[model samples]
Target: MSSGALTAFILRSPVFAGLLCFFVCAGPCPGREDDQARVLYARAQKLLSEGDPDEALDRYLTLLKKHPRTEWSALSLWDMYRIYIHQDSPEPAFEVLNRLIVEQPGHFEKAHAAQLQLVQRILGSGKEARTNLESVKKKKPLPPEIVVEMLKTVIKNGPHSEVGIQAHYYLAIAREQAGEKTEAIAAHEDFAETYSSHELADDAGYQSAYIAYKSWKSMRSTGPHQRENAAVALAWFIARFPESDKAAQARSCLAEVRAAELSELLGLARYYEARSNPKAALIYYQQIASRFPEVIQTDEVLRDKILSLKGAEEVVGPVR
Candidate 1:
């Protein structure tokens, strides 16, 4: 048999398997043993080339057990790591690489570089979410909700570099687009609250207010809603940077939310008016006009109130 194949057969034997872990040999061997190891390695390469990863993995494991301190041991382990990673088995890759790092602290730089690459694969690649976010435009494409979770991983594990901040910002945007309003709101809150000095803070603030308003609108029917909360958040956005370009947008958002609130009260007032309860309607109209006089609806409420008073006077047959 060839040297590589002979190694594979020898290592498969029970006696060799048991002795392999601690076996130490020096120099190019005379015959059988040298032939055996070469044969094993060659067989493994063949399996790997043929896409028989399972068999390839088993052979590598056997090679490691037999020659844990061999010069090529790290190479074998790294190959196994690559195969597992290629299979999308990050957990196993993580486990193996983690062990390798622990056992070989000298490999720290290599391990960390590998981690960076892996993070890109698992988080930014969008493979897990099954999306082509890289090639897709924001307006033309929809973000899958999974992007949020992926961003979280990147933010947690990636270095605290520009890439990290970018990850956080993208995550916030992705969450916003996925209609995960609460998470999106919280993410922006986190960004705006903690990363106020970040270069992207202004953009984040504008997007936060937009998301807050959208979230508030969607959750309006829920008791103790967030419309007012959204206004408060907008106020913070404006107060933090009054000169910011986004400040005008934040102000507009605040105005729109107040207008919505006033509109709601106006609707309620009309409901009561239709039911012939002018007193309750007046209360609602007055509340809207008094509390939110700047809203356009305030003028509409005042007109309704004036007409209601005139109708009441006519119904009572002319007050003196």
Candidate 2:
């Protein structure tokens, strides 16, 4: 608007005065802006309560646009989201939520709380009204992006918070289900390390180690690298949570990984020997013997072959 018309409008309407405050003394007039926001919000609430939802929505939209950075904008966006959803306008409802989530950087707690309410409403509750485990147990979880946003808000608020800890664990789960195992592992490990005293700490730590282990174990063509990853993951879980209920399972998985690795090394050694490269064969055999002495000693035939290669390597010398 022209400066003249704008000034006239600002003078004519008390609500429009707040909009001009932004133009005249934006950063310096927080008190004015906040007070004006409350006025607008009260006006919107009265309109809504009087059954003039359309007018209430307009008031809220104006408040959001004029005082976007004020805390009242958060309430405005939330009310707008509710109104859109009540009207069955999915697109606008999503837009309002995105505005709260993405544009309003100051409302981390509000955003997270709103998301939880939305999730609870959409997914239907089980026996517990409040649970750290609800999202995972849902038959149809919210979309990955929504869960991610919720997690981000929770994390941004602070991991020491009760809700933040739950969010950290759930965020890893969401990433895992989205096939981002690397990110999932990192998130889970972070949660475990940062909240080692919490009740779910062991669960987080095991999941961190298990994601990579499970992937390697399930692969059709498990390479040496994959076996090594599996072994390391299982070993980590065993070390980190030695008293955990899952410790025995981790031990079993680690043994399987070791066995598979030993098999690969033995196969490589035989392949080298078949190629007339006894020097390379000796190296692999020695590695397998060194790494798996218990397993090798129980197999007399393999032990004898390693001894012979050692004898030959002593006479012929190492490959290098």
Candidate 3:
């Protein structure tokens, strides 16, 4: 049982000698580091499949750091990217994805395309977030705070990039959907200003005006200030986008606002006339006739009213 006897015995047997040669030539046993990495990768995948993504993410990160050159490293990075996306942390997800694309283009091409498709879907360039809509209806939509964070990331990091433009557009839609009219208008305006040459610029401009008009309509009481704001928005839209598809609608809204102003002036004139203030009533009627001549027959009626008021004042000797 001495070492020399054992070696001799092994060398004397053809089968044992062949097995030893094969083992030596095939290379040393797989390293402990590789074994550890494999075990960790399997555990991470299991944790993810069991709905423990946070733990899975930690495990994957550990594997990547400890076994960077191992075969599992690329796969671990990809899985981590998926988890980040599922958590709505697109910034980190993008980081991981870019790394994967740089390190293993052939392996990650499909994943990169999938990520782009997801972004397009959320931005309504695709089927309008089918999964997201379902999640919303089920009361399980991704956290709004997280979405906001992701949007901010896209805007800040890729402002002039294609994804950034889409992100801006999507942010405006999100604000509108949440009933944040002022915020929506601001976002739309920002997109239009920042990406003037983009195809969506005209649409953004139109949406800004439309949102302003809608806000004006939803008010219980319309005043000069409200009318002025709405009128300005419509006028901007009309002048800036006369050739736009929404131009007709913008012009109609403008006319409605102008008519409301004319009606208001007419009401004031009538009220002054009823109160025996002929001079004041005449001023109002004349103002309307001069300012709104395009109001159809109303211009002639306003002029006639002005003349009658002046006549009444002259006959009454300007009653105070």
Candidate 4:
């Protein structure tokens, strides 16, 4: 139809005019899509302001379907995510947020801000969560899965924020509580590496080393290799956090590991001595005297033992 005839038809039949506008104005109006999207977006926001989130969600979804490539669609998706979060449905919120992030990379900060808000809503204020964590020493006292999801969200969305740092710290605790020592250590390490300037960085490092130390210490038959790893971890903790409150404990742990190593060496020396292999026994005794003199039960006793072993080996012709 000619523009004039269409205008006349629109002017003559209001119902038809309304139907025409619904289909034409609401559909893809190439050059006018931006204006149309703005109008639709305003309507959705109005619905939301009027406490009709269900209707607002419908309008936002319709806006997306009609103007999928328009900038307004990205805005609509973000609003939809907010709606889902308000409705306590994180699954859809995450879905919409993922789409918004991918479709509008420049809007990543907006999406990240929105995700942080959602996480805060889910987990409450950071101070409150921290207080609860400090008070509760039980394993998985908070919902592990939900806390884990929040941690992932913050780490992925706002890794440099205070919330992200806190999430990383709490995730380590949660993983440890859940008996995931390896994952806990990794999380603590990641936090320490990524946020070295953060106040909790030293604590994160300590937790990582302490977890490894505890695992090895609790073993029924701790081998030299395990002892070595645990000692290295404790030593790292001591070096990294010399002034930290945990430093003393770390030193003590290091001392215990060294003592264990020395004990193992002495046991080996005694075993070889029982077998009448003075040369082999002497090697072990010398290892204790030279490599672990500090851990020897007594300096004089270790020296005497080393000398006795050496004399016995010489008498046996060095076991050759």
Candidate 5:
């Protein structure tokens, strides 16, 4: 239709006339360009409602370029991302939503939800990265090397997001499980220290203590008593958060270490006794009884200390 004929048809259409009258002035317009953008945007919404996303997206993009702040541009972009998600193209959806998070933090919840949906979909599909991971698992148990590599990927890509701590924690656990005790201890320590103020601080602290205790226990024969190390780690947790709910746990762990130390002293006493060194055995037993009087084995240790001292005194014929 000719422009004049089309105008006449639009004037005859109640919907078109209503929109024009509501949005456009009857007099000469100084901001006619902006009004034209609004008209296009309204038409895009209409097309989207009518199930014409292709055309709707085209017009929305045009409107955005023409008048980026038409008050509906953010919504337009959000809609585009939603459409991408519905189409099962989550990569682009996540990208757009992530950009929205950075560009408009007030809308971060919406963007974060969208991104989480995309990640879940990707994981649920059992494809891409997830597929490869599943496939590898089917072939053989994941080696320490592979687990570490996977964790590193999450850490490197997820720093600005909440995924960093998760990745690091997983890697640390994987390392510990794979018998890489030293590396696991280091990883847990770093994660707990670096993200102390993060949302995952408590979780990190719990895991750090748990992992360090286990790793140190397993590696004790190499020197530096493992129970002592575990005690030190528990102390760190307790000192850092004195009133934490985990304080009870830390106290229990400290008690275990104290008991272990007493056990070590008793073991040394037994060794001296076996070697027929009554004086040394007596001294070690007395040390355990005196220093660890609150230990669970305190009563037995005190009786042993008395017997050892009496035996040593008889062997030495009453020392002055």
Candidate 6:
């Protein structure tokens, strides 16, 4: 049939006009572009599945250009993103994801999830760069504060999402990995308290407490005394997260922290005893005897001194 005859035949049946439009479009069909865009999306997906990414990309770009503000166009960007990612072209893939985030609006739940994945990719880009030892030999680690702010942004944008929960948990891990123990302790505490029912909450709580326990050891030589703080934090971990895998080690470390406290008390006691202040010395001696029997009572010589002190209390408090 000639073009005019075929057009007349198609027009006579509404269903044929509709169905044939999907297969043959001579020019722009303004009112039918929505269906055309939908057809393009489905065609692109099929082409992609058949391993014809180049053709798939062409169809996606055509849809995006003709249907700029439509749902099909928005959906096209994600498939384009997948193609770029599969091609190992991260720059385009990442750009497409960014476009999806900015241009997306409405009940596009999958689009929102993709946006979060972009957030994770961007924040972890620094870590990825560090993975290839030779490539990043001269590169410095991401500043701990910067990593922290990025994760905080996710929590602000999507607090209840799977991404947000992970971001909150990783904020502390980032701090700890960077050796910012003080900041790590603070961040971990926040995660545990804010998301107590989350799967990672116990791990967060344990990290904060463990950092508190480990920090004093390095600081004691040149910094202030933190034995009591360490002991308190570690003991709190055991009580609060008894079922945590790290709790067993925490219990052992609590003993070490108590021992440090005992050593400090012994120092103060000896200082007074050397100056002939036996009564003041007896007070700390009594504290050590009462508070840290596991540490002090094991030594026979120390045991004799405790037994000799008249004002010393014969108390042996077990560590909680």
Per TM-score, the best of the predicted structures is 3
Per-residue C-alpha lDDT of model 2 across residues 1-320, encoded as one tens digit per residue:
99999778779997778777767875557798899999999999999888677899999989988988888888899888777656544345655766776888776566655554453343332122332211322244456666566556656656566766676777787777667889999988888888888888888888877787888878898566777877787788789889999888888878888878888888899999999888889889989888998968799999898888789878986556
Task: Work out the TM-score per prediction.
Answer: 0.53, 0.60, 0.65, 0.58, 0.48, 0.60
TM-score of model 3 vs. true structure: 0.65
**Tens digits of lDDT, candidate 5, 188-259:** 777778877765555556666766666555664633366667777787877776766777887787776666
Instruction: Identify the superior model by TM-score, candidate 1 or candidate 3.
Output: 3
- Cα lDDT tens digits, model 4, 1-320, are 99999889777998987887889777556779888889999999999888788999899989988888888998899778766655556557766876776778877766765655555544543322221111323232345566567658667766776655676787787677668888998989888887877888889989898888888878889666778878888888787778888788888888888888878888999999899877888888888878876655567877887887677767767333
Q: List the residue pairs that clash in candidate 6.
A: none
Residue 238 error, candidate 3, Å: 1.5
- C-alpha lDDT score of every prediction, in listed order: 0.67, 0.76, 0.75, 0.76, 0.66, 0.72
Model 1, span 164-263: residue lDDT tens: 6667777776776677777777787788777888877877877777776766777738322688888887887788778788888789888888777777
RMSD of 6: 9.6
Candidate 4 backbone collisions, by pair? none
lDDT of 4 at 71: 84
lDDT of 4 at 57: 89
Alpha-carbon deviation at 239 in model 1, angstroms:
4.6
lDDT computed for candidate 6? 0.72
How many angstroms is residue 102 displaced in model 2 relative to the true structure, after the best TM-score fit? 14
Candidate 5: residue 45 Cα off by (Å): 26
RMSD of 5: 11.8
Better of 1 and 6 by lDDT: 6
